[model samples]
Target: MFWFFCAALVIIVGLAILTPVWRTRGDNGAETAAGFDLQVYRDQLREVERDLTRGVISAEEAERLRREIGRKVLEADRRAGEESPAARRNSAGWIGAVLALALLLGGAVWLYEREGVPGMPDLPLAERIAAAEAAYDSRPSQTEAEAAAPVPDRGEIDADYAALIEELRAAVAKTPDDPQGLALLSMHETRLGNLEAAITAQRHLIEVKGPDATAYDHLMLVSQLIEAAGGLITPEAEDELARALQLEPQSAQGRYMLGLLQAQNGRPDRAFPIWRDLLEEGPADAPWIAPIRAAIPDLAWLAGQPDYTPPKTAMPALPGPDADAVAAAEGMSEEEREQMISGMVQQLESRLATEGGSPEEWARLISALVVQGRADHAGEIWGEAQTRFAAQPEALEVVRKAATEAGLAE
Candidate 1:
């Protein structure tokens, strides 16, 4: 069908060009300017003779007119007898028209051959979506993916480290229900490139945690599962992600993993918006932010938004004492300065508790408490921030940093 339309267009253009050439050629034999001039001169000669017969002019005057008209008539006759330039131009036109048509058709064919798919069928939206679904359904299982994945090469370990790992494995085996041992075993196994072993240990850790398992615990299991499958979000990993979200409905990590699953399963239409929202609700330093920014432009193109541009992101300003407050503190005595600083901290905490605040404010408050030798209170504030920013991974990360600095988290 495409070829047919191309051929029809070529023919239409050829006709428009060739029709003028053919018409000009056919009119080449018709009366030309020289012929018409000769006829006018002959008519003028006849008029002069009639004027002589009617005595409108003297004989000498009439004779002069006859000679002038006769000379013009002879010149016109000579010119009319010669071949016209139109004949030569008509002949050249035919050659030019043929050459132009040939060039047009040849260029069209060459361009299409270079740039177009000759036999591919049209892919409309519905067909494309169906194809994506087919690919999603036919994806390999976790075991198959792991089997096909390339093995990582960890250079030989030191003898002491290798012996320690073996001893840890034996210890974990003896204490199968020990969450701490399982967690340590998982971490060490992951470090040693034993992804399968890491996944097994993490799974056992979650099982031992049981009803006490947090969303973070399940997410850790999911992370190991995905790594074991060589970054493919397998069915087992997806199940763990669902469980994590069930435990904490506002889990940012779980939502990010969910978006990743959708992306891997040929559903960028679903993934793009999830990642876009995460990008917009950001503190700019979340672990997921980098990957989302890297992948979103392509996802948006796939989602039929070829013009989408990611929003700019920057670190939020943390709330704290201003320059004026620092300057005023320089003149006060130590005791008085302490009182003023304590009052400011208390005021910030009160406003945050009463009206809520940004993750930066929460983090600032946590840091302030820690500076005042209030580690226990910092831990409590960190817990509250985790719950408050649970749905926003970027925001949660900001507070998590302060909590980690206060020695409240690893």
Candidate 2:
């Protein structure tokens, strides 16, 4: 379906570009050809005659100019008579036009084949969710030995967190099987880097969630297992990953972890397609996209294919000075740079005070102050932006994010 759209687009562009060439097949550059210069010379002679009639030029001067123009016109007529072979010129034009059209269409297809997934199938959101189910059904099921395998050790932890862990344990013990409590425990353990505990909590969460449990739930369990084993994808974890796909094949974390597991296990061929499809359908600005994009080139090479160039992502920029400004500052002496930076910010502030600016400009001012490590100044700008853009949520968010980055948020 994607290929069809691309082909149709190419056809439309090709027709639009080539249509004029096809229509003007008889244009042999004749209007500007040497043969047509005679008309130009005659026109010049008429202009001189008009000048004489208007009494702009004396009769003697006009006659001399007319004689010279007439000579050039006659010479032009002779060359045009020699050059006139309409059929030959028309044939040449036709040949050139045909070649141009062929190159245009052929080049498009050739480039797409070389640098693009020319005929790659499109996997819509609905289709990918269904595909996950099919993929899970096709994979080998886990063995009893794998299911019975013990959870990996989580190793040492800090005293403060360990004390909190005891409290979490007590709560879970009292409830026995509360899904919400277990879910919180799982996430908290993951945050504390206690993968073993996270895995245990997630399993209990799944038991309580039951059929209500989603593919994301199973996938998260697989994630905890892998992290606990120092990134080693155990058979039990793989089984959980399969269960995830069985529910939602397009689950971002599930597909990413599965592909990562395959790559780790030295099966880049399997990993490449999964990663490729994920990138195709994943949000350009999603947090997961950056790592996936960074890994694809290596994956392609491991698969013995040409290096892949993933599409650009929409990752947010750090809320501080832009690279160009930072680099320019780096080139200046410390004091000079400080003075210039201070002046630039001061100018922005003065303008905002004297002539109120937009929310975006306010956001920029706050970000600049943050980069300068002036939290107080950023906070001031944040307050002003809030008061100014209170009714506009989107505009307010821009300034609000800048303030938060500047450490001014309440």
Candidate 3:
């Protein structure tokens, strides 16, 4: 509206300047011609008087010349007076100008009303995230709904990996402050069902990531807690979840997990709305939607809201991490970026040697070396890994795969 008013004011002031000029165009021209003719007559009259004094012409001749010039000046004055501003004013131009201004202003107002948002206030990103977390926290706890929630089986872990696990544990203890070691330790510890150890490792991971840690990092920590509790939300996990949601209130995964937290706490009233809203608003093929759609009706029952009609959302799997990374790297040139990635790979290799790391770190090193086209180095790592995890074939497979990618498997 401010912009509209500004534009209108500019046009009106322009029209005001131009309208009088257009109307008086003919009258101004006539007055200018009259002034020029009067100046010519006055100059000739002066010459007539000078000639008479010098005796170049008689006084009688000079008088006749003066009278003739004076008559011509008077005639010019009469004509200028006859051409009044009213007579010379352009009525047609005045009409056209008024019509043009009206059209411009009217069209602008019409288009603005049709396409522009009238009174919507802008939402800053930080405020938006805070609001979302607050909304989630305000909802009821799903205590009554906890019993029927799905729990995935924690199948038996291979006993052969026990020795390798011990080695990694000792290596981590020696390098307690290393971020890479902690993340790697956390992943494998979770796989081995070492809940407390994994939780500790995850805390170290969060600490190492520090201020740069994103919502996804905090959310992952919460996930590790849920796993340790066999699909329950321990009080310890709530703090991590709060941090995640505070970072990104609109995070699809975070919201879904919040619903899970509510369900585990037996707050069906809260869980039902969270899941239902997420299902309706999220992408049609988001990975979390399928499970959410399935659970909505049962969650509704627990909420004592029987009118919940199940949405017929489809079952396509969501795109994975590779697609997401590719999307993020859209404007970067792969050829120029290879050198930077190679530098990082060298640094990782150096760190692993000096600080020591988990099997995951070794696997990452092999992969980075292969990506850098260092097949010889990758092969050496794979050989050492074979000796280190001889009993754990699964662990060796990670390094072996990277060796194959580097063309050293033969």
Candidate 4:
């Protein structure tokens, strides 16, 4: 039906263009203004001759009129001779009409062929939603996805490190319920590209934590599951994501994984808003921010907003000691390095206290305090961060991770 309408429109336009050329074809040899003027002048000269014969006008008058008429005739004849022949004019007109029509039709066809899906039928909103649902229901399982995924290359490890990993694995296998051992195993396995093993260890960690497992714990399991399946958010990962969000409704990573699951299951309409909100509520260096920024434009298009422009948000400057300070300290004597680091940490602490800072800065401050053997001060800062970022769950999560590392949180 669409093709029929296009063809009809082309025919109508073509006819409008060619009609004028065809109608004017018959008029090509018709008498022109110059020819008509020449004929009238000759008639007037004949009348003058009649007047002279009848003695109504003298020979002088008659000859004067003849001379004037003859001059006018010469000018009219010159103009007529300069005009193009009717056949040549008609041929050129036909050629121009043909070219115009060809360009119009051919250009339309070429553009459509280049940018359009030629034989695809129009998919209504309802049908499209149904198709998406079908795809979501039929997506691959976790085991199937992992089986199909290519093995990742983890370059050669040091012999001592490999031996340490074997010992860790044996320790975890011997005491399967040990959470710390499982966490260590998971981390090292992931580093060595043993994703399945990493996932298994993480799952065991979560089981050991049981009711004590926080949203972050489930999110860890989700991450391992996703990585093991080569980035596919399989059913197992989705369930874990839902459980994480259920445990902590404000979990940033859980929300990110939910959006990812929606996107993978062909529901960009659902995914786009989640990601857009995450992007807007950002610290710029949040782990999910980069991926959200990269994916949202296409997600917006998929959600029927082709003209949507993402907000331009600049990344905030790092609030702690800069890289140059660290490099300078690297070449100093141990005591000098310690003094330099202490100075830098004091500077960071002053700036953060005076102007406030991003969650990342707070996290860095907490870690630095722990490293300086000021666990009491670090605990005080962590307590303050909880109050400061109480309303911002994602930011609080960032600070909480550092607190956990410093033995300040579970």
The Cα local distance difference test for each model comes to 0.78, 0.70, 0.67, 0.80
Local accuracy of candidate 2 as per-residue lDDT tens digits, 117-229: 85567766567546655654454323332355454332344466568868987898899699888987887677555556777889999999999998878876876666555
> How do the residues 80-120 of candidate 3 rate in per-residue lDDT, one tens digit apiece?
78754634455556666767767877886688689977665
Residue pair clashes in candidate 1: none
- Candidate 1 TM-score versus the reference: 0.57
Q: Regarding lDDT, does 1 or 4 come out ahead?
A: 4
Instruction: Residues 1-410, candidate 4: write the lDDT tens digits.
Output: 88889889998999999988877875664346667888899899889989999999988888899999999999888777765466568878988998989998899899999999898887888988999999988979999988987774444455766888899999988999998999888767765667778878888898899999888778777777776677788888889888899999977767877887888878899999998888988867665675677678999999988897877898677654567877877889999988887887898888776656777888999999999998766765775565444324466678889988888777
Candidate 3 residue pairs that clash: 141-267, 142-265, 142-266, 142-267, 142-268, 143-265, 143-266, 143-267, 144-266
Q: How do these models rank on lDDT, best leading?
A: 4, 1, 2, 3
- Which runs of model 1 end up more than 4 angstroms from their true locations? 1-116, 315-410
Query: Of models 2 and 3, which has the larger lDDT?
Result: 2
Residue 368, candidate 1: alpha-carbon lDDT: 90
Per-residue CA lDDT of model 1 for 118-231, tens digit only, reads: 778878878877987887778788899789876744444556667888999999889899988998887677756677888888888888888998888788777766765667
Model 3 spans > 4 angstroms off = 1-163, 283-287, 301-305, 317-410
TM-score order, best first, reads 4, 1, 2, 3
Q: What is the lDDT of candidate 4?
A: 0.80
TM-score of each prediction: 0.57, 0.40, 0.39, 0.67
